[model samples]
Target chain A: MMVSNDDAALVVERIGPQALVEDSGRFGVRHLGVTQGGALDWVSLGWANWLLGNAPGTAGVEIAIGGFALKAEASMTLAIAGGDLGATLDGAPLPPNGAFAIERGQTLAFAQPVAGLRAYLALPGGVVAAPFMGSVATVAREQLGGLDGRGSALAGGDRLLAAGTCAAPREMPMAPALPREDVALELVTGAQIGHFEGASLFATFNSPWQVDTRADRMGVRLTGPELRCQLGGMISEGIPLGAVQVPPDGQPIILLNDRQTIGGYPRLGALSPLACAALAQCAPGTTLTLSPITPHQARRRYLATLAQWR
Target chain B: MSDAQIRVSEAPVIRLETVGMDALMVRLFDAIDEAHMPWILAADRALREGFGEDLVDLVPSYTTLLVNYDVERLDQREASACIRDALIGLRPASTAAGREHRIPVWYDESVGPELPRIAERLGVSCEEIIRRHSERDYCAFALGFTPGYAFMGMIEEALATPRLKTPRQKVAAGSVGIAERQTAIYSMRSPGGWNLLGRTAVKLFDRERDDISLFRPGDRIRFEPITRDVFIEQGGDTTPLEERG
Candidate 1:
């Protein structure tokens, strides 16, 4: 079904620092050196879609650090999840986790992060954008995916068009708990895990690390104890999402979806997807601790969490 | 060696580890070498083919292939078992057919700012530098750092040099650089520390093309020295890439 001009959905009124169209993620193309661009907090993205009766992996907008405003071009059903970006619908406070309707001319504004760093806005059937590299997820550095197809963040004057009729409001089957202060980010050790000194490993698990402002979609830098590794010079190896690499500086930078396909720094391990999502919601200076978990335990917990969506 | 010996020899050293919920890191070698390239490429293709939809993404580096799969479908034990079985079906690298390319590069002081410096450091003339650099075929061991940027390697040792002390914030796409027995064309304009020797007229990455990336793992590349006028005529689009002659 085609979305006519009468129900054009959202119109960009004011823009924020960073906003991009994202989905489950871009896959099967990392071999081309193309980084997989996806929602940093995939849990919330899934919830936002669930609220609107859209597929869990449907494409949606990820509003980062707030300051985004959208005027409803047409009456439509939309949902917001992740972060308490201080959302207000036509001056009325709109909470996250449930679907809501906006009449024509109604403006929905996201002011600032009240709870989480990013909030996903899901419209019925998702906004219109052709999948690039098997995904509509956006990565600016690679200049791929998203609305403009140039891998750019949302700008003013952009129109969000969604297909499908407005239905009754829906909610997530089981919403993951919101992030709290000094949350522990669980990690499963990788190849270079044994190469690190036992002292550093002990400190890595015990120490409280501060999130450096240098964090981005590529990776998050933790400024705390210096993690020492015995491996002198390591060859650049394939890095996966949430790979916790400790550079020579001893600071561990957790690689994300937009991270370089490969790196040479010694790695401690990779964070579980849920732990990564919880860590992604954290703003700069947020205190975080790394907890080591067996790969089997991480996998079981992940499967358990994923069961909620299906 | 006989087939049994090859299988027995290859089986003991290959190590596999569960990277995350969605990936398995298969270690092929303890160090970097041209010999390991075949193993990396063979494993990459074999596992990718074997797993099919189960594999999300498989990245082949110098000595490892990080096989990313959907943990929802296959658990750690099952995925590792599939990988080990896939490794058993691998053939010798001599049978693999890698793509070939003759990339044209404008190697001169005017285009390559570090060319003269590189020549002086090696105590060789600029012409000799270009001749030695372009004469050999380089194998693309891996693709990383950025999209479509193939990490081609093992350049002739004579021209190899260390990377810049401070990497330039912006190195234009197509800028060919040689550092520590490796020469790679900057597939896109990004910050890099490789010693720039020349610039290529061809864009190795073109999204508009049916096959987005020009070079893949095991692809053979030979650099051809071209004049500035010829480089200009080639344009920035897909018209520049020439068939290897």
Candidate 2:
């Protein structure tokens, strides 16, 4: 099977709670006080693009808790990955992490999530849009970079286009190892790690943290143990992705891609990127535990994961 | 870049610590002051000159410069060591240049949601409150909490107030506010607790503008008090500013 240059177009029939155009991430502009707006699950975006023989960092659509439907305006090969969003093409099942062609009248619909919270849809030449700040990653809060270059979620009647062209279909040599059933997130102990009292530390590691309903692309609020950090009022500081910050209320907020550029809260540390990807896939009420990994260990794991893309 | 006065031995020793696996923070002070800006700016320059591509992004806030790096090229230990050494060699900011933007603000009882209450609490008149607030020329220290939301300040000590007892459910974008030493514009309609001073006619952030960010670090801001008529004359969309063109 191969992709075609038949002006492949996707028309949004029904949009989910959220659907966005995303690349790997917007880099080198964090100093401009811009947040890195990209795929919450970078791993899945890579795999979707890879299935279409596109570069790993190419743009794709990120559908959250799918209730989305798209009608193909022109026949083209596309790929999907991430959480099983219970997708079906013309009522037939479309499995994840595989590429297939769709006819002009075919309708691809995704119901509620089966396992994962997000699904990525990728095309041969990737979705084409003018770049803002050198990226097309949709940041709803920032209102920058989307199909319209205005950062709005996929709306009904919107037409999606790719640099549609023919390319040889490629299959994954082997699928990456899926995350374990018991979700154990890994965080590297850093800034203000010593500031937390031993009791809080004990609770942090031992207790199961529940993902609060207040979770979003900005960050996930973990509610369970009130972690006390022994520090005076903090001056605002740069916040990295997955930084586990404890505010005055003692609840921890694990910041993500759409998080603000800086914050003034004491932090326990930042979670590994892989752990963040896992956390992104989690729905509200999901209980997970934080496992401390050395920075060295995190580097090895992150690089090893990136190695699979090429 | 060359015209800086940084000395290795005389400068205060900067602490290099970890914010996360991918980021190394070079902290200069616990809190921020005008004195710290030069040091922070200098350190930022030194790091950019020193590490180059290994440095992914450097986010400078009031007290710390958070450096995100490629873990493959520079691990945590090396990044910290490199930052620690670079801090010693950081050059002092030499006549750092920044733009001066005079924003038009309508300071009226009706214009400011919390002005009357803040005036009563401070035992001052609403006019007096506006006078002290618009008098000082505050610098943009950092942007965070939200996109295009600039944390610019060093407000007059007498006018400084703590965050609202309970933050407002929503603060309109372009609303000017003060909380403690910091004064800022609520660029987006986000929940904020700052004492609302007034609203500005000019949107602080507009994606349609040539420069997406109106306020940058080191930039000076002065509020030009305008009449209500002038505020309306300029597209007075008092609703929250959406991040759009």
Candidate 3:
């Protein structure tokens, strides 16, 4: 799908908070030392795209904690997924995970989130944004991946245009709607899992940890009892998404999409791909538990999930 | 060579595992080292050439290759086999030797502020320290920590210094610095703590340029001293190395 200049929808004005555009992320350039900056909740972004009949990798808006408002200058079809942030269009309440036909000159707004930390807004074809290193994901820190390809965050007076015109609104059945409560994140034992003291390992699995306020696209610091490990003075090593690292402070910080490519800390384990998605939707102070699964099981489950998406 | 022979040869450095529904990571090695560079580069090229359209992107870090693909189009078994077959056909390229670039730097007080402290720790004159630093050629081990940031290797043993006890809030772009045995050039202004020796005017990273990065992994680099006048003429600011890129 492609969006032309004449067919583009303009953003006349924003009412509450601004929205930053994102895609899967700029990949393959990490060797050039670029960070993978992309949607915080990849699953939600994919769902938004699936609902709009766009490819899962298509670009969309990632609104953090809601309050984003926009006025459409042209008729368009859009989809919202991830956390329910009380989204409304032209003063009419809109639901998440479904497509809607937004008329030209109508205003779309979101209030403070009642649940979930981020909401994804997807256009029919996708958002038309400049690509940097082959991705339009906005990473404000590196100033890469955005409309200008300098990774600028959305602000007032910025107009968001859709890449392609909307077709008839597609309906996603509720049978597949993701469960919003009591998610169990799967963990795959990592290289340093053996380093943690035996009791600490048991405690890590047994105890409930709260997502601390210190959270962002980079990582989420989990608040829980101090977990001791035997390893020390680790040579800085490459970090993967969902790796549960324990720094000197002993609290676990699960790395995410916008995380640095490398780190030097003892890691307990990594969460399975689905678990990371589940964790992405979780808000601060949300309680979570760690459960280990074999790599075979993890791969099987992950492949099964992808099959459904296809 | 037969499949058995390839399997027995240099057991895959990275362990393959599922990252998410659509992502899989090939953990090159547990730690970073020069020995792993050839393997990593070979694996990256092999995947790209062999998988062709089946692969979304192959992300190579210090010791891991995150292979992303269109999950809707390919399954784990098929993808895993394709990756394995590509690895069997992999051969380290001669181009992997990489290119070399000589950067001109001004190591005087105008560009360098921590030079004196570094010289004192090494029990040498500041000028001597600069001479030793500029005399040797260095190998680019990896491009990481930041965009276009080349992490070179094996500085003079005497010149090796630990990162600052507390990192500076911001390090200037084009700042040439050393920490432990690794030396690096800061591509953009960001927080860092490497011992600053001097600065260069060349843009290490420019999104507008075809070659966005000035240096890459496995390149050779040397520092050539330049006058303050030449530095400014080249578009370098007069601030300390930490404040100018």
Better-scoring candidate (TM-score), 2 or 3:
2
Estimate every model's Cα lDDT from 0 to 1.
Answer: 0.83, 0.81, 0.76
lDDT of 3 by residue, A1-310 (tens): 3646744565735534446788988766766778877887788888888887788779998887777888887777889888788899888888866788888788888887767767889987888887878889987778787777777877766778787766666676563334355556788776568789998998899888888999888899999889999888675555667889998888999988788766678887778777887787788888888899765677787677656557
True contacts kept of each: 0.73, 0.72, 0.39
What's the CA error at residue B204 for candidate 2, in Å? 2.5
Candidate with best DockQ: 1
Candidate 2 scores a C-alpha RMSD against the true structure in Å of 4.1
CA error at residue B124 for candidate 3, angstroms: 2.3
- Clash list (residue pairs), candidate 3: A3-A163, A17-A67, A143-A150, A273-B20, B14-B27, B172-B242, B173-B245, B174-B245
Give the C-alpha miss distance for residue B178 in model 1, angstroms: 1.6
Off by over 4 Å in 3: A6-12, A15-18, A175-181, B1-96, B241-245
- Residues B1-245 of candidate 1 have per-residue lDDT tens digits of 11221211242257897677678889978766666666677788789888988998998888888899888788888899999999995654642456778999888665476788878887889998899988877888789888899888788777778888888777778888877888898888788888877788787889889878999987778899998888778873223212110
lDDT string for model 1 (A126-240, tens) is: 8788788778888888888888887888899888888565577676555557776878899988867899999999999999999999999999999998889999778887888
For all candidates, state DockQ relative to the true structure.
0.66, 0.63, 0.34
Tens-place lDDT digits, model 2, residues B1-245: 12233222235567878778788888777656765666676787788877788988888888778899888798887887777776665666653554678988988655466677778988989888888888867777887777677788788887777887777777777788888888998887777788776788677667789877787776668888888789889866555322210
User: What value does the lDDT take at residue A108 in candidate 2?
Assistant: 93
On lDDT, the stronger of 1 and 3 is: 1
